[model samples]
Target: MIKFFKKRPPANLPDFWKTYENCFLEKQPEEVNSVRFVVLDTETTGFDYIHDRILSIGALNLINKHIAINQSLELYLIQDHYNAETAKIHGILKNGRGTECITEIEALKQFLAFVGNAVIIAHHTIFDINMINQALERHQLPKLLNKTLDTSTLYKKTLLTSNVFKKKDHYSLDDLAEKFDISMKDRHTAIGDAYITAIAFLKIWTRLKSKGPLKLKDLLKLGS
Candidate 1:
């Protein structure tokens, strides 16, 4: 009789990953006000996810239209890849005194721990989500599993869709900020942008709710 080698079981995910993943095990709240919303933004070296590096990630939780500024996440990541051309855009120099920068792994760890299973809201949801997913992939981790909301799309839903006013395919954060009268005080910075997004989202939520009863499911369904 030939003896066959026993197949080994795949290793379990690390404790941090497990902790992040476990947040989803509990059912999400059904009501909009009861649900937690995490508005997030990332500042990168460039557009190409494969080549670019995330210089910073800023995020804060919004609940019942209130954001506790003291509890926000404003993480700057140390860089190995630098782009001089884009420095002016994000204002995060390679080794400048912006904030205490951490390693990529540490940043990812902190970001994951902070985000948990809250609904993620961003301006252009796909771009930021893809950028983060790419970073996670490079670190040999699973992609983000949280539901995402795009203020761009949600903002469109609040608009009047008539032949008189055709909706543009895309809307910039600045456009929404201008339309909603949200100040551009912290336009490019990660945490600043996240705060702007949070305010814009609350305004849009009011518009959406004005039409009818808007549940958490309604907003989740509208977002991509």
Candidate 2:
């Protein structure tokens, strides 16, 4: 009789991945202020998760309402897939002028190391996370295990629900930046957007805190 066996993770997984996986073994902090958050952004060739490629990834650490500028990560990836039209938006040329581009594997390694087990924050979290997950799948690696928060959704929670003020079903990153008075000097770039997201999150956190004491789980529920 013939039988099919389930595939398993390769025993020879990279050291970096093992290190990242190890981070989850420790319990996460319950208090929102005590937890480490990684706010990140990705510049991609297009929105198609299956076909598009990540042009660059940018991330920064936030803890206790403080953004750790020194603990920031910016990585440009080298890929044969290049879309001229999309390049017009992100402004990353095939041969990035002065940017040092690395392989997808290397970028994943660096990203996993920088992210650790921190909660992830992004404007529209699903797209960014999916793009990164696709890259990981290409390398036969597991998807990211970190919890994620969407500023777009969380921002909506901060708004007052009244007959006079009807909230839109969707809020763009630009809307949050404008509402929070964050600068748009660096809009399209990955790192620039990450910085904007971080500030927007801070504003949202403040507003939510004003409503009541917010725990990590409560914030996640609001975003969800």
Candidate 3:
């Protein structure tokens, strides 16, 4: 049944995407400060484009520099395809740990409900976002409409582009986590990692803002 839907396109795409996209069409505040941002991640079976499947999704919402524990998206999916090779990095064993699994469609529905109208923030935004989009496509749903901000890009903004050191061409979750002293307690879990990313982003924003006024558009800066 799942295979029939894979990569084809989503059916009965929830109305949420339309509404979320509409938020963008409206006039955005000139000050880039008052926006809601969602940071998220996907645990996949493997790195293979064709073989890998999303095993889980973890995310947290950031509004006005606050992160509330009750408001997070942690979804475990039922995936027959599990990769032992990536287990060490993400730690989701086949039928071993983590919460009970939900179907891919169920997870997407819940994810949409949680993420509605908020700008998405993620580390390596494309992969995670695309993973979700592929799932949506399979369900016949359209792509996500929310604006996206990548922390890797935001982290780069903290660096000085003095034409020396090249300002670290790339930034990884591990790098930002270490720099900010954030514990990897919920390391392999989606929500735990999302929390880590959220905190790291805050620290980066603080440092950048100290230099001058900050705005939502400014934080959306993926590059220097």
Candidate 4:
């Protein structure tokens, strides 16, 4: 099932995106450290957009630079199409094979409830977002209402200004984990990578807002 946003923009989305821009109306805090962010990911069967199936969604909530392991969401989904090759990458088994599993609808409902108007952050956000949107489309739920940030973008801001320390075209979770010295014990799980991105997002927030006002507008602008 694939869900598309209603043809008209939701009140929260600007006239630009047309799925409800109003959701963004809530005033963001004046400081960078005071925001609530949802860091998340999906474990899928493979790379083919049409052939793949999302096996899981793992997410954690961060508030004011703090992460509470207890305040996280981990949902395993039932898969109709399972790929054996990628199992080594994500480790999710098909056919009710996981420790705990839920249907796509169940996972979507839980994710919506957990996110509830918070901004979402992820590394290489487009892939995860596309996977989620596909799932949402399949479920016929309204499209996501929250704003999004990508750690791949945030991490770049932390580099030095000199041309000597030139930044790369793209940054990976492994690169940041190595650079920041964050633990990699949980490497590929949705929840684990989310934790890494959350920390990286926090670090970037600290570096960028260290000498600035750090308004909500500032964060939305980070995408540009």
RMSD values for the candidates in order, in angstroms, are 4.4, 2.5, 5.9, 6.0
Q: Model 3: how far is 47 from its true place, Å?
A: 2.5
Worst 10 residues of 2 by lDDT: 6-15
Which prediction has more favorable lDDT, 2 or 4? 2
Can you write out model 4's per-residue Cα lDDT over 66-89, one digit (the tens) per residue?
897899999888777878889978
lDDT of 4 at 150: 82
Whole-model lDDT for model 1 versus the true structure? Answer: 0.89
Q: What are the per-residue Cα lDDT tens digits for candidate 1 across 103-182?
A: 98899899999999999999998888988989888877888989999999999988888989999999999999999899
lDDT per residue for candidate 3 within 124-195, as digits (tens), equals 788888888888777777888777877888788778777566767777888889999999878767777788
Give all candidates' CA lDDT scores: 0.89, 0.94, 0.78, 0.77
Candidate 2, position 149, lDDT: 97
Cα-based TM-score, every candidate: 0.93, 0.94, 0.84, 0.84
Sort by TM-score, best first: what order?
2, 1, 3, 4
Off by over 4 Å in 4: 1-27, 96-98, 161-163
Q: Looking at candidate 3, what is the lDDT of residue 57?
A: 94
Task: Judging by TM-score against the true structure, name the best candidate.
Answer: 2
Model 2: what TM-score? 0.94
Instruction: Name the regions of candidate 2 deviating beyond 4 angstroms.
Output: 1-11
